[model samples]
Target: MTLAALAEQVGVAVVNLSVMKNDRARAVRFSTLTALCDALDCTPGDLFSVVDP
Candidate 1:
């Protein structure tokens, strides 16, 4: 699905979703994360990863 479509499904603006897509977001609310997971039918583990920095 397109970002715009996903944004609509998740009840967020396209620009906000774009920030998350680009890894520019500093934080994400649990509600928003849940919405994304529900829309994509995926787990949080599928969407994020941990890295040594």
Candidate 2:
């Protein structure tokens, strides 16, 4: 889906979603994450992975 469509479906601003999509976001709210997961028909584990710092 397009970013605009995803943003609409996820109930988040396009700019915010763009930031996340581009890996430039510093953090993500749990509510936003859940909304995204629900909109995409996926799970948290599907969207994220451990990154060594």
Question: How accurate locally, in lDDT, is each candidate?
Answer: 0.93, 0.92
| 10 residues in a row with least lDDT, candidate 1 | 44-53
> Candidate 2 on 1-53: residue-level lDDT in tens?
99999999888899999898888889999999999999999998998887998
**Model 1 stretches with alpha carbons more than 4 Å out:** none
Residue-level lDDT of model 1, residues 1-30, one tens digit each, is 999999999999999999989989989899
Clashing pairs in 1: none
Compared with the true structure, the alpha-carbon lDDT of candidate 1 equals: 0.93
RMSD for each model, in Å, please? Answer: 0.6, 0.9
Clashes of each: 0, 0
**Candidate 2: regions farther than 4 A off:** none
Residue 43, candidate 2: Cα error in Å is 0.5
**TM-score winner among the candidates?**
1
